[model samples]
Each structure stands twice: as C-alpha cells, then as structure tokens.
Target: MKFFIRTFGCQMNLNESEIMAGLLINDGFEWTENPDEADIIIINSCSVREKAENKMYGAIGGYGKLKEKNKNLIIGIGGCSAEKERDALLDRFKKIDFVFGTRNVIDISNLVKRAMKGERFADFSDKLNEVNYSIPKRPFSKHHAWITIIYGCNKYCTYCIVPYTRGFEKSRPIDDIINEVEEYNKNGFKEITFLGQNVDSYGKDFGDKKPKLDLLIQKSAQFDSIKRIWFMTSYPSDITDSLIDTIAKEKKAAKYIHLPVQSGSNRILKSMNRRYTKEQFIDLVYKIQKEIPEVTISSDIITGFPSETEKDFEETVDLIKKCRFERINIAEYSPREGTVAHKYFEDNVPKHIKNKRLQYIMNLQKKINLEENEKYLGKTLSIIQEGKAGKNNTYMGRTINNKLIIFQSQEKLNGSFLKVKVNKVSPGPLYGEIIEIINNI
Candidate 1:
C-alpha cells in the first residue's frame, strides 16, 4: 500500500507527519509524494491561523473528489485543526476515515490498520505518558533534523489556539531528548534543532523553573558530529540570563533566537493576554543582543488585533523600527474560535485596515532585512550545506545566525560544513562562492 502525507503548519507539525510516515513505512506500506497513486492519504494540519484551517478544509474537499475514481482511497486528518474539530470534522466530511490528535501519533500504525478495515476513529486523548521516547521517524532532511524538546503550550496567548488544541505543556525528559540527538548524530545529521511551542518554558512542567532547554543545548553540544544546535518559538518572558549565557558559551548553538512578540501596544498586548509588557520585551531583545553580539534576532508580529487603534498600529510600527529584526513574520489578525480573543473580545479591526497595517510592516521589515544582509557582504562566513538551490550549480546553506546563502559548488555537499565568501547580498537571500570546504570542525 502507498501512503501520501501533506503537512501544513509549523515545524512540529512537519515532524509529526514524519513520525506518521515512519509508522506506516514500518507497517509494510510505501510512501508516495503523489496522492493520486496512494492507497491512503493524511493531512497534518494547523489551526493557529484561520487561513491555515481554510486551506486544510479546501484540500479535503478537493481530495474527496478522488474517492469517486478510486473507491479504496482512505483519507485521514491529524494535528491541531483535526484535534480542535474532531467531532465536527467527521460529521462535516464523510471522506475522512480517521482523525488523530497531536499526542496520538504513536498509534498511527494501529489507526491505519483499523482505518483499512473500514473502522472510523477519532483519538484526541492526551497520550503524554504513552509516547515512545525513541519512536521511529523518517526525517525530512538528511543533514538537519528537529528533536521536539517539548510539546504543547501553556502560555495560551489570546490570539493563539495551540494551547487548547495541543493541550498544556508536556516536556520530554532530558535523557530522551539527548538519545534522540544521538540517533540523529549517528545518521550523519550535522544540524539538530530543539523544537517546541515555547522552548524557553521547557522544564517548567517538570516542576522546576530551571531552564532545561539550556541544559539540553549544553548536552547536545557535546556530540562532535552535530555542528549546530537551534531552538525556536520562545516565550519572551521565559527567556533567562542562563539561556542567553548558554547560547553564547556553547560553540554549536546557533546564533539565532526566535522570540515572538505578537503585538507592540501595551493595551493591545494586555487585551491579547501576553504576559510581558512592550518595555520588558524590548529590554529582553537588547539583553540577548548584548550577550550574543553575533546573533540574528527574528520575531512574529500580528497587526489589526482586536480593539487595536491607529495609535496601537503605530506602536507596532515603532517597535519594528526600534528592534530592526533580521526577519519579522507579519500576519493580519484573524479571530480563531475557542481562543480568548474570540470568546471575549470582538474582532473589531476592519479587513482593509488589517491589510494596510500588514503591508506597511512587511515593507518596513524588507528594508530592515536588506540593511542587515548588507553587513555580510565582503565577509567570510561558515555555513553547512543544506541542499541544491535549483539555480544552475548553486547550492543553499544557512549561516550560524540562520542566514540562507546560495553559493556555487560542484560537489554534492548535503551535510558538509564549508566557508563561503559573500559576493552578493539582497533582502531575500545572500549569494556567495564556496571558498573552502571544512571536512571537520
């Protein structure tokens, strides 16, 4: 049997899809990129944004038409959106055979077996204890892999749906994470990212305020095979001095921080239930920059949030100018059902207004990104070969600070680290030529 998986959302969702594919592959099933030839199809979903939810629904409808031609085709939905609307989804779409939650990925093989036998299933139960620490996975990348250091979120930002869908914070033990890193290392993977919704709050669920992510980074750095360690989607307030110091001191830790500050207006932030104030967030960014001078800071910004005023929108613009983030993921706010904002606050921002705000922020950041990338010109930087760039003999790799550079190389350098001399820079990506390949760091 052939199975096809289409993933949507963040990195965690992508990793979950790999786990599902691994389970199916181990069950005597083949993986296929073309859904038309597959016996089973699964959509790993995201519900953080209404746009993502709509895409998943549209995909289901389009794929559902395939059942008319292929009577034996089995369709499955999993991840945040599926978990969020488990009951409604099955009732809404007859093509869906099985629906599994974020924590229910371990039972994928069993679920597929039952699904093949014509038994419909929806398993959204919390399976924190039942998860296999060393579960089988078919990683998407050969050289870089994501090890989920923590699962779910406790922050429950008013505009977010991750907490309700994925459930509360449940962190894996340090030993288990290290073991996963070792597995990736054995597979010749040079870059390993510690992934989570709120990575900075990794160990708080274990009943300790200690930053276990820092400790995990420290342990993962000990592996000589791993060249870079990275973590992401940090909660601003949870970032500790220890975490900053650990990133600075560890040779393998990637000099990039993805701390999201959703909105800049204090009043709007408060309305959105973000714990930290704008002033505090600014202070934290400055501190991270001061401690790790080479670090490239990235952030997420949401415009036209509920009850946002022209002043609030300006405040966000002002924050962008002040921070000058290497990159800022800008989004127009859409009220998601079951979130605090949806339940209590009104989605009062006009759509046109949201679009205007989003565009302004995007243009501002594009200018800022170009300014930042210009600094790399005429400089030699270290980069690990990620994959082919699809342009002639050029290949793409990321710098230690997470800058993607395209450079020409004749050799197949998927996992090898190399030095590149930057010859061109733009707002999008840096162009360079490989100076020398580093066999070992």
Candidate 2:
C-alpha cells in the first residue's frame, strides 16, 4: 500500500506527520508524493485559527474528488482539529474513515488496520502517553528537525483552543530528549529546535524533580556535531535566568527568544488569562536584551480583542513601538469555540475593525523590522546555510540569532556554517558577500 500525509499547522503537527510516515513505511507501505496515487491518506489538521480550519475544509473537498475515483482509498484525519472534532468530522467529510487524537498518534498503524477492515474508528483519550522514540522519522530536512520536548499546553489562554485539543502539558523525559538529539546529531541532522506550546513550562509536570529544559540544552551542547539548538513560544512569565545563562554559556543554543505577549492592554491580558502585564512584558524584553546583547527578539500579538478600545489598541501600538521586535506574528482576535473568551465575551469587534487593527500592527512592525535589521549593515555574522535561494547564485541561511541572510555563493552550503559580511539589510533577508566558509563538509 502507498500513503500520502497532508499536514497543516505548527512544527509539532509536521513532526507528528513525519512519525506517521515512518510508522506507515515500517508497515510495508511506500510514500507517494501524489495524493491521487496513494491507497491511504491522512490529513494532519490544525485548529489554531479559523483560517487553518477553513483551509482544511477546502483541502478535504479537493481530496474527496480523488477518493471518488479510487474506491479503495482510505482517508483519515488526525492532530488538533481531529482531536477536537472527532465524530463530527465523519458527518462533514463522509469519506473520512478514521479519526485519532494527538495522544493516539503513535498507534496510527492500528487505526489504519481497523479502517482497512471497514470499521470506522474515533479515538480521543485524555490520557497522556510517552511517544515511542524507536519510530523512524522521515524529516523534511535532514539538516534541521523539529523535536517535541513537551506535548500540549498548561496555560488556558482564554482565546486559545490548544489546552482543549492537545490537553495539559506532558513533558518528555530529559534524557529521552537528549538521546534523541544525540542520535539525530550522529545522523548528520545538525540543527534541532525543541518544540512545545510553551517551552519554559517544560519539566514542571515533574513533581518534586527539577525542571530540565536548561539542563537538557546544556547537555545537548556536549555533542560537538550539533551546530544549533532552539526552543519556541516561551511564555514571558516562565522564562528564567537559568535559561538565559545557559544560552549565554552554550554555543549550540541559538541566541534568540520568541516571547508571545498576546495583548498589550493590561485589562485584555487579564481577560485573556495571560499572566504578564504590559509593563512586565516590557521589563522581560529589556532583561533579555540586557543579558544577551546579540539576541534578536520576536513576539506574538493579537489585535482587536473583545475588550480593546481605541485607547487599548493605541497602547498595543505603543508597546510594539517600544519593543521594536525583530519580527512579530500578528493575528486578529478570533473567538475559538470551547475557549473562555468565546463563552464569556460577545464577539462585539467588527470584522472590518479587526482587519484594520491587524494592518496597523503589521505596518508598524514592518518599519521596526527594517530599522532594527539595518543596524547589522557592514557587520559580520555566522549563519547556518539552510538552502540555496531560487535566485541565481543566491544561497539562503540564518544567523545564530535567527536573522535570515541571503548571499551569492557557488558551492552548496546547506548543513554548513559560513561567515558573511552584510552589505544590504532589509525587513526580510540581509544580502551579503561571503567572507569565509567557516566550516564545510
């Protein structure tokens, strides 16, 4: 049998899809790039935003057309959306044969087997399970991979659907994560980004045991082959001095931080169940900047929250100006079903207002990005080559601080590090001239 996995959403979902691919391949199924040619199809869905859900619907219709021609085709939906919308998905996509939640993803082979027997199955258990590290992964990039250090979220951010879909935070054992990174490093996947909805919350679920993110990262640095280590979506309240110290001490840990401040209004933040205030977030950013002079900061911001007034929106704008974030993911507040915001607040903000606010945020951020990046002009930076850009002789890479750099180079530099002297800087990638091939294999 042949299978095709269509994945959407965050790195976690993508990693899950890779795991499924490995599992399916182990069971004697070959992977097909063409969805129409596959005997089985899985849509690893996301429910983070209404936009993501809409895209999934559109994709399902597209795949449904192919299912008509191949009557033997087995279609399945997994990940966040399927975890939340299990049985309901069958009514929506009549062709969908099976539904499994995030936790049961490792048992996907059994689910496929049951579906092949003409039995429809839906599995959404609340119990947390340790992932089988023995499964081989067909990672999209051999040079870099997203490894989940922890699964799910403990923060019940009023607007977030993550806690409901992915359940509470369950951390993978620190040694397990370290061993995984070491194996990947040995296999020549040099860069690893440890993933979690909130990385700072790692090891908190370990009662009476010390939290392990800093320790795990420190140990990961011991592997000489691993070039870069990264973690994501750090809750501002949870970031610690130890983490900052580790980043300073370890050459492998990327000197960048992504701290999400959902809203700048103190009132909106309180309503959103976000622990930090606007002042506190500013202080945190300042603290990080003071500690790590070379660090680049990115953030997540939501505009047009239910309680946001013109004054509130302006405060958010002011915060953006103050922070001057290198980059930001700006989203218009959308009420998610099963979230506290959806239950308690009226969706009083008009669609037009939400969009306008989103535009305002993006416009301000674009200016900030350009201005901040311009400072790197004429400076030398060490970047890990990601891949070659489609543009002639242009190779794309990123600085250790996660700044994108595009430069002219002849040799294939992917999976290697090089020094570049920045000649031109923009809000996007900095154009540069290669000064040296720092390390090439």
Candidate 3:
C-alpha cells in the first residue's frame, strides 16, 4: 500500500503527521509524495483560523474528487480540526474511510486495515496522560527534526480549541525526551526543536524535582552532534526570567523566540483569557531584547475578537509598533464551537471590519519588518542553507535570528552553514551574495 499525508497548522501537527507516517511505514506501506499514486490519503489539519478550516474543507473536497476517480482509495482526516468536529465530519463525508483524533495516532495502521475490510472507524479525542506511544521513525529532513517534549494544553484561552481537542497537559518522561534527542544526534541530525503546546510548562506535570526547560537546554547543549536547539509556542504566563537567561547563556540555543501575544488591548486580552497584560508582555519583550542582543522575536496576533472596538484595535497596532517584531503572524478571530468565547461572546466584529483590522496590522508590520531587515544590510549573517529559492539561482536559508535570506551562490550549500554579506534588503526577504563559507556540518 502507498500513502500520502498532507499537513497543516503548527509544529505539533507536523510532528503528528511524522508519527502517522512512521506507523504506516512500519505496517509495510510505502510513502508517496503524489496524492494520485497513493492507496491512502491523510490530511493532518488545523482549526486555529477560519482560513485553515476552509482549507481543510477544500482539501477534503479535492480528495472527494480523487475518491471518485479511484473508489478504493481510503481517505482519513486527523489532527486539531478533525478532533474538534469529528461527528460532523463523519456525517458529512461518507467517502472518508477513517477519522482518528490527535491523541491515538498509534491506532492508525490498525484502523486503516479495518476500514479496508469494509468496517467504519472513528476514534476522536481520548483521555490525557493515558499512554506514551512512541514510534521510531525517519525524519523528512536530514539536518533538522522536531522532538515533542509535551502534549496538549491546560490553558483554555477563550478562542482556542486545542485544550478540548488535544486534551489536557501531559509531559513525556524526561528520560524519554533525552533518549530521543540522543538518538537523533546519533543519527546525524544537527538541529532539534523541542515542541509542545507550551514549552515553558514542560516539567510542571511532574514534580518540581524534574529539571525544567533551562536544564533541558543545558543538557542538550552538551551533545556534540546537536548544533542548534529551539522550543516553540511559548505561553506568555509561563515564560520566566530563567528561561530567557538560559537561552541567552546557552551557546547551542537558537536566538529566536516565538512568544504569542494574542491581543494588545487589556479589554480584548481579558475577554480572550490570555492571562497577561500588554504592559507585562512589553516588559517581557524588553527583558529578552536587552538580555540577548542577537535575539529576534516573533508573535501571534488576533486582530478582531468579540466586542473588540476601534480603540482596542488601535491599541494592538500601537503595541506592534512598540514591539517592532521581526515576524508577526496575524489572524482574524474565528470562534470555535465549544470554546468559552463562542458560548458567551457574540461574533460582533463584522467580516469587513475584521479584514480591515487585519490589513492594518499587516501593513504596519511590513514597514517594521523592512526597517528591521535594513539593519542587516552590509552585515555578515551565518545562515543554514535550506534549498533553492523557487526557480532562481539564489539559494535560501535562515540567519541565526531566524530571518529568511535569499542570496546568490554558485556553490551548493544545502545542509551547511555559509556566511553571506547582505547587500539588498526588502520587506519580503533579504537578497545577498555569499561572501564566505562557514561550517559545512
């Protein structure tokens, strides 16, 4: 059997797709990149934004057409969106052979086998901390991999569906995470991103005796094969001084942080249950920037929430201007069915208004980003060459600050570090020419 998996959303979804692929491969299934050549087509989805949700529907519709072409092809939907609306999906898509939730991915192979035998299969949203089902698998990349340090979220932010869909907090054993990293190092992977719903809250599920994130970074840095370590989706409330200090002090840690500040207005934040004020978030950003000069920060911003007024939207714009984020992910709020906001708050913000607000945010961000990139002109940046940038001769890579740079180079530099002097800067990407070769590891 052949299988193809399309993934969307955050790193967690990507990691889940990796595990699902591993399971199928272990079951003697060959992986295919083309959807048309596969016996099974799986979509790992996200529901954070309405756009993502619509994309999932479009993907399903496309698969539905493929099913018409190949009646025997099994279609499966898994991940956040599937878990959130399992029953509705199963009812709507009779052609869908299987639907498994985020929690019980280990059952995929068996479930698909059952579905192939003319049996219907649907398992969505299981209990938290139920079992640790770790499957050994190959990564899509040779140089980088994601290690999921924790699963699920305890924080029920008003607009988020993750807690209900993925269940509560569950931290994998420290030894398990360490063993996985060691194995990746042994296998010649140079970079690992410690993934979680909230990375800062890693060891809290266990007793305080277990080492926290700072200690984990310290231990991972001790390994010679691992050159870069990073963690993502940090919650503002859990981000501590020690974590910032550790990243600044640790040589191997990436100098980028993706701390999400959902809204800048205190009123909107309270409605969203973000737990931190704009002032506090600004202070935290200041601390990080002051402590680590090379550090670049990214943020998640929601433009229009329920009851968000013009003043509230302006506050968000002002806050973004103040922060001057290196990269900002902007989304117009979409209410999930079971979330706190959906039940209590009316979707008062009109579509046009929401879109206008989102545009305002993006427009401001464009100028800020251009200004930030201009600072890098004529400076040497060490970048890990990723691949060819589109059809152009230029190769693409990211600086240690996680800024994307496209530069002209005759030499092939994939999976290696190169030093490039930035000559041109744009809001989209930095255009440079490779001046020197760095570590080829």
Top-lDDT candidate index: 1
lDDT against the true structure, each candidate: 0.88, 0.86, 0.84
Worst 10-residue lDDT window for candidate 1 reads 125-134
Per-prediction tally of clashes: 0, 0, 0
Off by over 4 Å in 1: none
Model 2: lowest-lDDT 10 consecutive positions: 125-134
Better of 1 and 2 by TM-score: 1
- Residue pairs with colliding backbones in model 1 are none
Native-to-model Cα distance after best TM-score fit, residue 423 in candidate 2, in Å: 2.3
For 1-441, candidate 1 gives per-residue lDDT tens digits of 999999999999888888888888888899999999988999999998989999999999988988998989999999999989987899999988999889888788888888999998787766667655578788888888987878888887888899988888888888888888898888778898888999888988787567688889999988878989999889998998999999999889999999889888999899888999999999998888889968989999998898899999888888888888988888898889988888888888899999999999888889998999999999988998888888778889898899999988865687788899999999989999989999878
Per-candidate TM vs. native? 0.97, 0.96, 0.95
lDDT of 3 at 324: 85
Model 3 C-alpha RMSD to native: 2.0
- Candidate 3 residue-wise lDDT, 184-298, digit = tens: 8888778889998888888887877343887788888888889889899799878878888898988788999998998889999988888999999999998999998689999
* Candidate topping TM-score: 1
